[model samples]
Target chain A: MADPGPDDALFVNEVRGGDQKAFEAFYRRHEAVVYRTALALVRDEMTAEEVVTDTFLRAHAARERLDPARSPVPWLQRIAVNLSLNHLRRRRLGIEALPEVAAWPDEAATVPEAAAERRETTAALARGIERLPAQMRAVVVLRFVHDASLAEIAETLECPVGTVKSRLHNALRLLRDDLRRDFETAQPGTQPLAAPDLGEMGESIG
Target chain B: MTGWPDLARFILGRRAGGDPADECAIHRPRLAELVDERALGGTQADDAATTAALDHLWACAECQHEIADLLLVVAGLQRLGGTVNRLEPPPGGWRRLSRRLAAPRPRGALRLRVAGLVVVPILAALLVAPALVRDLGTSAAGAVDAATRDAATVAVPVAVTHAAALQRAFDIGDGAQADPAAQAVEVVPRGPLPDGIEPDGSAFLPGVAVPPMPAVIPQ
Candidate 1:
């Protein structure tokens, strides 16, 4: 809670030496962020927890490879995100459905009406995101949710910053248009407009 | 002068918490005011700003509403971050792993004890049985050889007695030839004789003739 301090580096170094207490210290320090990041991607508490566990377990196994001189938090977070995405991708294939937005802990969605609206909006957002091409969704998610800088996103996605910006622009436009169409259709007494297909949307955005 | 669209783009591009250039800095507060007035439409109810500069968003109604909407989207995206399940370590997870690592190995002495239980008798039999059997067989064979030697020594007298009796019956006198007297004495008749006559002719005849005998002994 006191921001892990410089002690985290010492603990991580000890963890590399197979120190259980050091490993426990590391787990306690970063579990919340790791869990939150994983939960966002996978939308399931169990899967997110698994991702956190796996990320830590892997970090523990490869502790020697971790730079003891650096902050391990970001490195650990990166592992959790990558693992969570892979899990979501596999789950998506198994269900043959779009990835669902992860639900928050029971306490986060307190009011029933508010919860229901969040769920509906989340579902719509997931479908809209799923409809986007994979690269565009990555840029959008990184830019919007993670608040990653263009360079950081580009680095994460292994693409040029120009490409990241272009994709972000196109993805945001598509999302705005999709949400607008959905909003209109959900309103009373309005004739539903034909939603533009993904290719047409991409072309229009381009 | 830059158009409103260019100004909006430049304002949107401005990094939060970063220092902007002098020309952009002059327009920054006015740009924030315009954004507060026009950009979010009429969705936000209050337009009052607490600070003279653009930093009072936490209390401003218009700013709060816009920020809330962005935060809502951010919150929704944040929900999409990774979901975590709270796992307490499997009960005794560490204890179990520790127990496995700390368990004592079977000592060499214990292994030898087990080997003794399994192998000592087999090894003893291997060492002792062959020697015992060889000793028994050697003693039995020696006894057999002694009995055979005794039998050979006793057989010589019996064989000599048999030879002497054979010589006396033939009346052989220290030679291999048969005795002439013994040859001349006919032990059996050469021809058919009467049934009541004794072939030796010591003469107890019973009314039947004896056959004539030849006097010369055949050469």
Candidate 2:
């Protein structure tokens, strides 16, 4: 994670000093990112909500231990990610059910044909992202989704930068191949069908 | 915009006609390397190595397509944050956290709470079980005694006139055993059971069966 901004740092210090308003302000600033990051990993709304609750609750409980110099985003994000992963493990959901194909809504400005193609591509990408393993998905979300740098992701995940790179490479490689397979074999006009054996992709990527 | 569209068009265009099997084998990993660097917004590849990889990427149409596809994928991934934030927990979700914070926290509160849960149920069962069991036993005994009495007192042969009635009354076959005469004794009710009569059946006597009665309707 990047360093916390001066105002955010100040809030952390204030929260350590028992300022409820400062904590609330800090929450308001970072909650959306934390929630979005959790939803990306867990992909369930209610579980993600619980993750948000737990993440902030933990941050508040350990307020004195939080360093004002560090960006609280990574700290909060790591908690949400861990909790979301644990939720998935407890469910033994093994692999998630892929999202249903998104409809290509008609828009006035763009050509229907182009819009449909883009929509299909977007849906495929979304599904591919969803299919990544929990840890790989976390790396992808931090790197690609939130635009975290390699060093920042390493700091957040508490892994080596090389590990983050390998995971990202493996994740993108599988996602690209999966999406490519879908596009190649898809019925030309309809939504892409769910392919079987995502486990096979995981092995090949690994 | 120029490189972006050109990249998209060439990628989405027809694959270059050839035996892709061998060429794909060689370039796929290299393209993966370039794309990984590009995806991370930087390349660990030094300038010379970077230049050589880009040269090979431009020269190979398959590599171009792979790089193009990955770049598009990166764009889509970058958009995910915005798209996903659409599902952000609705405003004031913090109210739950705020409520939790406002609640008092004593050390070991969680352990105390869990222990309370386990202990309370066991304690309750200990306190309440005997009375509950006694009440239930008395009600069951009274029902059986009343049913057996009603079955025996009817003047008609129970199997003939009241098989259904007896079954309904005693939940058995005709309320008759093989030696019905020996088991049953005719009890003449001195009168209709007196109103407000309550049976205290706590006292047990051998060879004297006291018909269990219903609770008194207190006057």
Candidate 3:
């Protein structure tokens, strides 16, 4: 909640100077966001944790190349995203495997009700997001979770703004349709409906 | 009046601004009136041109509905964003990074230790091998010398036995004179026999006729 102070800046500067304390501070500051982003992409917590750790380790190794004047958050995010994507690619090739979770909602239920709701919502969103094609899911996660701007997303994805826009449009439409269908299904007495057809939406966009 | 869909597109495009002349010239003021009813509330001024375009929105319905739909979409998106939790880094994230950065680098010491482990023994082996070999060689030579001396001691008695057999075949006793009747005799004349000895006389016979000594001693 507090604004990052001179100490934070000093710490980052020290990290650039190869200071371990500063590097640890940076890791502690960004691990959750990195892990969450990785988890969203890889769909595995252990892999996500590895991605988070690797991201920080790389940042530490490359600190000398880092521009101290810029905030390290986005840079760190980029590293985590790339790592997560690489992990996915390797998984697809069968060189790596996804991790299994022992429990989920039950474990989350032990938290306070509000926290539980948030967790459930996050889990649902994550499932919906996973159903999307890879490129589209990446755009959605980067845009929504990281709150990255269109330009930032484009830069991260290494694509044009037009591509990012189209991906976002398609992804959001799919997500909306999926959420709607899921909502109807969960409600008792409501008949389960077919997934909303996005062909009309796509035609409208064009 | 402009058609509903075209009017709607024009209104949405105009509201977003960056509309070229071709796009803008077709806008009908009445369409704007229709669209305003739906999308007018959160039409924040996007740019100066967009603000100026609002004058058209004030009068067109089709344009109003179009803008309203766009606004609704935006609002929905914002709600969706709100529903999602704001992602924060894990606790102690930065602290962990700082600890890592502050920790001493171990690679240098490890490399040195490994090098010492690998190289020191090799150097010791190289320095110590020659001495070890020399010591081994000296021990081997001493053993050979001892064996040779033992062999010589053993051979002396065997050689005496062989000499005794040769003496018996010649029928020569330890203290015997040469036979007087032998055809040839070899006298080394090792310092004239004992005092007062004749050429043919034995120690027991002062005047004995031994065979005539050969003119030249047989070899």
Candidate 4:
């Protein structure tokens, strides 16, 4: 017989029945995405863990009404992303901004086939991604990190797609320039233009 | 006179449906124009031109929304674009999926199809692994951050493989148990989301039938 409810829905129902065990089970099942979203947004390990704990707490408190038919990841993400952004805003007001951390998770160990130059390029891009403004960082995370669609990102951020587009493009362009400089610095052999060439001078005179 | 931005916007059109790849190539000339021939010919970046173009790109809000396809290819943006925001999940023994499967599939309106497909199998894999101690079909060298990996390894449980065991841990964990100092914290004053109106899921789950997930989704 086909069970109409999926695993997530079953977990949701179990939690709704006031089973704390099921709730813990629910956290176990979904914590990865929720924590990943938070880490991507906040770029700090400690804060991301805190967000995960808080998200589950809120989920537990609201367990009575969670829709058992749906996957709970989105709800968890909304809460996590919201909390992560709040921390960023709060930190900005009370303290000097921390040196930008890469929005990308470190891949030195994950990418086995990465060549020397590929690793260098990714490092430069990661630095650029970290340096992007917080809001722009959010757009990039939602798009690249979570793989959310443009409209999905807009809905999550409570903004228009145009705004998301602007942020993403600006973010990419900045990364491009940052990567360009990385190459420029890496390529020590290339010489700078020193003097006007006679060929250029004759052409200009003509 | 129509400015560069106005012209670009007219050409790029509005991609509210989220298919932005078609317009990706249009912005390359703009990026290429920024770097000198040396940078173009794989020699060196002209400091003055590269700086000016980057400056213009920063100042130009219009250029910000557009993608340069050539730049994406040459700068290896396509390879990094999908995983840019991804970080390692807290140690729970789940392996990161292959990068190709993990890449964002921007081809269709249903953005979740690819990602959702990637997720379902992982969930199924975990559930089926009655003894989920080892990383499945993945390399052993996954621990990227030594501090976090080493510290969390002993503190957190090895892994929670099933919903059946959701009991013992619950009594010890009701929000306040997270920290001794957090006992006074109040529950967040929020209600459940309205029925059938899930945040990212509403767009796909109800309407499109992902037949594969339904079959393997464990109870």
Candidate 5:
């Protein structure tokens, strides 16, 4: 794991001392992560923006309580995750498509369009991820996007480690099936999709 | 698969190389659980049930298919993770936050200033109270002295008036220096006196004129 960023603890102390400059500096450093994480979960530009704003606001409100010895990123990410989840709950935007596959580019291109195809694959993957259940989507986002550990995700979601693993396992299966269907239908020449494998599972799967 | 970006490894944070778990009726309900354990290879790879499950799954085409599909899904998710553009705040978001921060904090210097505004006057009063009390004491003493002189001036006039009224009632002539004996003798009662009455006693009526004494006394 990367050593906790020095700025997180330092800026936390400065913000606790009522230093706005320090807080602004801190926000500038981490806002992209926070915002991207929210966008990954919510998939709505507006709500994701709200989540980002609320995350920072809450962080500032609780600045004094922050442990300056640790990285504040996880804490901030946790807040963003919670806010995004709550927003989803309030809107009652239940999972869109889980077992059901989302529509993908169903072309029959024979040529290998690497860059354009990758972008298309990435976009379809995002849409597929957004269709997952909120809780499952959170795990996927945290694990893949934020690179959080299982323990960190469990803490953030307030669930057991076993539950996190199960969710991530299920989430990976769902996205994999959806994206594969999209690829197979889109182009006959598309290759087996690759992914970040933290385990020996990747090579075996391929 | 080789040329394709290993998206699953990127998403799962590990390269897939372990044997896939075969389908178990008992583990079928908990396949994801079993698969997750296998996927998180490490000390977990040594677990008995996970090991047994994987050994069996390597021969199971259906379960292998599921694992392969899940890997692709994880890869898609990994790519999805990076798809989002870095977010900038809404227009003027930082400026708004700066404005809020610039406002005086409830518990900050503004609070101290307000406290000072209230306490400074009270402290000044406390500091000056003794001096004010001393000055008031001095002024009060002077006021008492002036009031005493005014009282004496009014009392002297009142006394002179009372003496004049007494002289008129007694028929004492002006410029006559009446002695106490003469004043006492002038008060003799002429009418029939009560049994125990005596002349020149304090019982005599002051304003009543006395008849001259008869040449012969009548019993």
Candidate 6:
């Protein structure tokens, strides 16, 4: 778990008192998680960096309101997620496709096959995740990347658990469809993975 | 969607005394919820829902397929988290962020200066230029002065625009900080970091089981 270190509260307290140096300390601690989380959703390196800056900026700007008793990571996560979604929405104005990292799996790991199989599932993520709608994508990232539960995802996205569940459900369904299509495309003559038009299994069907 | 309790109640009812043939129809709608519960390790209390879902899972190929798909999606997400865990944020992030932090806060002074400098000239031009135009009766000087006032009137908006922007920056500070509710709520512990899951976060999610295999596989 990311503790933000024991002095996190101290830094947050100092930050609330208008300490720039302390705010820097706070930003340094959380930047990686926030950046990677944003990257998982926004899929662009620079935009993910922008999201981190915005998250900390928002955190710093709102620093005086920071609760010294709480961990600031979730708050930071909330801001990063919001900024990522905003970037995604604004990027959609240009209707851009997701860029691939393509540099993954450079060295083979020596983990067990179960671990390896899990990696295979995630190997499909960067591609399949690109096809998800921004909201659903946010839910997916919060669940897996941030390791947040449905309720935590709801809080991060500021929606109800039901909405989280629904988005996650549809997001998974869409990802499954994309995966199936990809798997079928690889095969010689399979009838496109036979569970016809699971698109209707979207929330409308639920 | 048929919410958990309603669906669970129906499923439980069907399991108790309902027809066997209708299992798929009764259970299919809530398949997503069932999958989420299992994948997330049934965080919510079960109304014997997990048992009922599992019982249904072994008997139904379509349900098995759907559940398998959802679990794979969850596992994919879990793995995505692990993959991203290996990455570091670009170097000197704090340097760029510190630069952002050093940016000047929205002081009302710029707007004040804009109002004082621009508004004064604009008012002076508007008030004096008309007299010049009226008194001089189309003289070149008056015409020039009146044209200047027209330009000044158009220019007044620059201050107003800046004023609006500065106000928004202020609102971002005041309005967003109003509730202070975000961090106050406790994030439920994620349980434990599962295998293949790195403790990448400073204290991100430190909870729960590894992604599980689906109860039954579809042919």
lDDT of 6 by residue, B144-178 (tens): 23443334324433333223223323434444332
Model 3 lDDT tens row, A1-206: 12244566777888888766666666666566677667667767567666777788788788887766656666777788788888878877889975566212232433344454345444545557667887887776676555667777786677898898778766655665665466566785663222222222223212
Give the higher-lDDT candidate: 5 or 6: 6
**Clash pairs for candidate 2:** none
Q: Which ranking of candidates, highest TM-score first?
A: 6, 2, 5, 4, 3, 1
User: Local error of candidate 6 at B118, Å?
Assistant: 7.9
Q: How close is candidate 1 to the true structure, as a TM-score?
A: 0.41
Every model's TM-score: 0.41, 0.59, 0.45, 0.46, 0.51, 0.61
How would you encode candidate 4's per-residue C-alpha lDDT over B1-74 as one tens digit per residue? 16998655645563342223323334335445432121122333446544444444454444442323224423
Off by over 4 Å in 5: A1-3, A93-124, A176-206, B1-60, B85-93, B100-219
True contacts kept of each: 0.06, 0.43, 0.12, 0.18, 0.42, 0.55
lDDT of 3 at A131: 74
Q: Candidates 1 and 2: which is better by TM-score?
A: 2
Please report the candidate that would top DockQ against the real structure: 6
lDDT of candidate 5 over B7-80, digit per residue (tens): 45443432343323312443344445645544343234345555555655566656666565565555545445
lDDT of 1 by residue, B169-207 (tens): 344235434334432322233332333323334343445
Of all native A–B interface contacts, model 5 reproduces a fraction of: 0.42
The regions of model 2 sitting more than 4 angstroms off are A1-3, A93-114, A188-206, B1-30, B43-46, B85-89, B104-219
- Model 2 lDDT per residue over B136-202, tens place: 2123533334444444434422122223222323443344322344324343333322332222322
Question: For residues B1-219, could you state the per-residue lDDT of candidate 3 as single tens digits?
Answer: 269987777778768963554343444332232222221222233444444455555454544444443333333333333333243334544555446656776556645655565467556654554443233212342232333323322332322222322332244345443232321222333334233333343433436656755543321
> lDDT of all predictions, in order shown?
0.50, 0.63, 0.53, 0.53, 0.59, 0.63
Misplaced by over 4 Å in model 4 are: A1-5, A94-104, A181-206, B2-88, B91-219
Query: Taking chain A by itself, what TM-score does each prediction score?
Result: 0.67, 0.78, 0.71, 0.73, 0.72, 0.77
